[model samples]
Target chain A: MSRATELVLADYIVVALYFVLVLAIGTWFGKFTKSTADFFFAGRRFHWWVLAMSCVATLVGSYSFVQYSEVGFKYGFCAMTPYTNEWFVLPLFLFGWFPLMYYHRITSVPEYFHGRFNWQVRFVVTLILLVYLQGYVAVNLLTIGRIMKGVFGMPEVYGAALMALISGIYLHAGGQTSVLATDVFQGLLLLAAGIGVFLLGIAEVGGLAEFWAALPYHHRFPFARFNTPPYLHAVGNFWNDAMTATFAFYFINQGVLMRFLSARSVREGRKAMLFVVVVLMPVAAVAVSGAGWAGRAMVERGILPEDVDAGNIFVAVTGKVCGPGFQGLVLAAVVAALMSTLDTLITAVAAIGVNDVYRPVLPGRSDQHYLTVARIVAIVSAVLGISLIPVFQHYDTIYQALSDFLSTVAPPLAVPLALAMLWPRFHARAAIIAMVLGMILMITALNYPALVTPFAHGVDPSEGYSHMRSLFGLVTSLVIAVAATYLVPAAESAADRLTWFHIPRPRPARRRARHDIWHRRFRVQVVPGTDPRLHLHPETMKELDLQQGDVVYVCDARWWLGGLRSVHAVVGEPDDTLPRDTVRLSEEAVRRGYLKPRHRVILEYEEEPIDV
Target chain B: MGPWLPYVYVYGVGGCVFLASLVAGVRAGAIDLNRPADRRTLLALVAGLLLFATVHAIWIWAASQEPPVSDQAAVALTAETRA
Candidate 1:
């Protein structure tokens, strides 16, 4: 192993400052996390731009920087394959799955399983998903540890432990709210730091022209050779990364689901998804892979030793191009990548643990009790992640370990979930059989290896047939699902508001009104009742266009919160006894909208089209 | 393999996946072909794929035209080659 590169005092100071800034942001957001909704979904109030940034930060994990850089050095532009090819999965995600999950208010993937199929399906899916998420956390922790070993000479396990502690502390305090807020800051920092390193490296290699000219011609192509090499090839990546892995991330990953659910509306969520795939993802592709490309250019120009380890290329390149303090900034970006992804994963595991595992066994618990358990589960998740670091260390490259894990784990779940959402005929029994049989086939492929050869598509299988495993699993599961659905009687009823075809359409408003027009502020009062009614004084109702049974939106006066503190209620009989400027809301509406008692709120008629 | 092979492979394979999904959606009545909104979505999907293919083709063409170190020469200089 190569000796770690030591840093100067300036570097240490910069890193320390970054850590302090992250913790401070987490603390600030912790104040807003008051309920399970706040902890898991951030009160569903964030704008598309903020969520887009956070999603990019979460997507570009520490493993992305290191592994993509290593591949960028080895194969050049093909490092972008994973990020660029996600568009193929866009149709299913945007049209089919997004609406179903948003309108149904599905909290977790397993929750959807329970709603769509049966408890048995939910139980099976919950176990598989927990394993997938915990394994993801392990991969990320191991990657950051590798970076620490390269830069500071610290042992890998210690580095991972320290990161987990930092992330766990803030996650325990604020949950999803803290994760979203800190990720925005970390996102900007990592992007700026990555681009800065790239530009500086170009200057070091004489100029952009010289750098371009130094690279080998074959490396300039955007795709690798068709299928010659077992590890890095166009065909294998198209199947593994683009087809299977992309589906897993966008469709099934709990962290990504939570990010979408945190959006204020389905439209905002769609905007965030579009921005992530179209705009931010390509930029992130460059940000994560640029260092490796620069490192290769340096090697060609004889600026660095030719035999430098590919795994250490990112650190070596950053050290070569950046000055003392700036190197620390770039290092902090790596840490930022790790922490952003890690915190999201931790929160997701907590959601699944509480919602699927803990809540079912002990139902009807108080909200406070569930909230406390969620925090405890977050801490336990961090500890469990750190413990798995050793298991992932056996792979030659971090990229290999992650790809193997994703390809193996994603298909079984992805196949069933896609069918459950799209195919109305698919029932509970088919789903259960598919998952069980799929997992068994995956395990068989793992031990036998030759079973995957039929699906290899001419790619060599010597490198453990990592990518082909996804194809085998998906095909096997799909076949099983189809056969069982046909063979077994369609006993289960069609899931209402659960499948794609049955998503509730927005009814047209009774009367036309100006869009987003807000009325005067009124003091809010929570009337003692279970009725879904918002009672306003006669004069107040008249001013806001008086109509009984009309839907109205009541929101906090502070518009900057982006409807986080908001609720929708039906207008009731005008209350002549109440004060003219006060609105009376049911206790449930007040709680659902997170409205503060006695606080002034603005009311609007709900006549505009619903944009779901 | 030629430089254009990756593009062909990607679009050929990716196009199948995309089309298959659309068919499934239509069969399930999840995506109605008669609706204007759904039709627009289909058009956008086709356009997006074409846009990626066009941009990648142009990028590779531009990069191919540049005078760079040949693969043979670069491999000769390096002490070890991964591929």
Candidate 2:
């Protein structure tokens, strides 16, 4: 069989159109990004649905399609184990870490360490996190390059470089805003194409019943065998994929954290998290793995050759089932998956570089200077990511490479992070020791697989012991952190706002009859003041039920921007000189909110809660 | 391994993590289980877990019962049609 599959002209046209559309959407959002905050977190303005959808795009990495489909063909529905098992972490995330990060406005994981512990902890974490994020970028680029080679007969390096260049262009243009916007579009396309492949495959096989009959009995099981298969056992995958990797993705992945931070409110962020795990993930599991399942069924029925390469199962199946233009569309979805994830990781690296590395070393720089630095870092990050693609090419399978990489790096950082968030008694000294020791131990396990044998849970360590390394790392790190915390003297106390304890609860709204009149929109003017205050006409204040010293949320009338053009301010003494139809915001508030000088704005009572 | 083993492993190990996080949240005063909203949320999470487990178990059982076409039979059928 030929290494490369043939593609018709229609396929090229569809892929080209997809590239143009994504670029257009990304660059269009560029105009809205003015400051570092806007560039990194999209001005904290996205609605929950947008964040949720964009997050789904990021979560379904390009490697997800190639790797999961490869496994789906070989194993069966067990390919979905990673996606299905994320629900267990939802409670910890929503109740513990989500609010901690959101309310405290922690921009990066390293920044959180700095705030909760000390500079030493932050510096240690910053290095590990940079390696992890850049590695993630490399994994994505490599997968897309593999796809290009399988379908278009292109060299892997050139394909990887092309993808990196495309992702970097839009990320440089608009940053997080562009990433969010383009991801939403790509997320939908990804789901549609994935499901479309399965549907088309079903038709080719005669019907759903025929498809089911075509799969072998052993392949129909939902989980892999318990422990016999050293490489892909249920027990080993539980520790590596479900527990360690998933925890790292939500807790420490800077890209995923930025999605939550970009929410308009904490409540919206919670909604997005619930929707992602409960609704989107299961669908995404099917979407990403459907091609492989179909391919397996087709092979069983002799619709395709039985000797089809497992690694190229996705491309083989798409070529067999999808006709001309439709084939291109499916390929575009693969590109969408790669680009969506790559852009997020690239932007995240930029945020970490600027916030954690650059700003601390050179404090008191202008926002513009930092913004320029962020853009430059984004370009450099993409370049570095492309360079690492060659390193990952040595691994036998994409699944093994990604799983081994995440399992090794995630547990050490994940254990320390969980301890820091949940256990206030966890000291800075303990964090530093645990993180350092954890790395040493994990690296030792890489060199000496025997170290992981004890934690392998009866699985043979001879073949694929890497998956069990996470369990070993976690146990060792937890023990070291606990022992060190008690043995060492504690330093200064962590502020209540930073820990899970003493998270500020929202106060109940005032007891009063609500009226539609309070929803009135008013024209905003920049008052000559430096304080963060909003001035309202007496009648307007009375109508909105606002009082002096009350915290009010003032936002641009164009609600479609979400909360991008919004700010919270203390309501000043009513300005009798102002017109009833207008409200005046301090110059500082206007600038902070990115509010237009003469634009109409709305005001609502913001029951000021005690800061966490 | 039994068909029920995967579910057992998932909930058994995953259940510990869930409970530990819940206990930590309650201890931190971040999650007030006494509140109606909090209680409802906890219940919903438990229900969702059980629901997924039930659906997966049913799928496995149903799929297991379907008689698969033998490889030789499938290949023979294809060859016959081609001839």
TM-score for chain B of all predictions = 0.69, 0.64
lDDT of 2 by residue, A268-352 (tens): 6877887887789999999999989999999988988989999889888887888888878888888898899899999999999
What clash pairs does model 2 have? A497-A612
Q: Give RMSD (Å) of candidate 1 vs. truth.
A: 5.2
Angstrom error of the Cα, residue A610, model 1: value is 9.2
**What lDDT tens digits, residue by residue, belong to model 1 across residues A188-227?**
9888888888888889999989988878887888888788
Best by TM-score: 2
Off by over 4 Å in 2: A1-3, A145-158, A387-405, A491-497, A510-546, A549-570, A574-612, B33-44, B64-83
Residue A193 local lDDT, model 1: 87
TM-score of chain B of 1: 0.69
Clashes of each: 0, 1
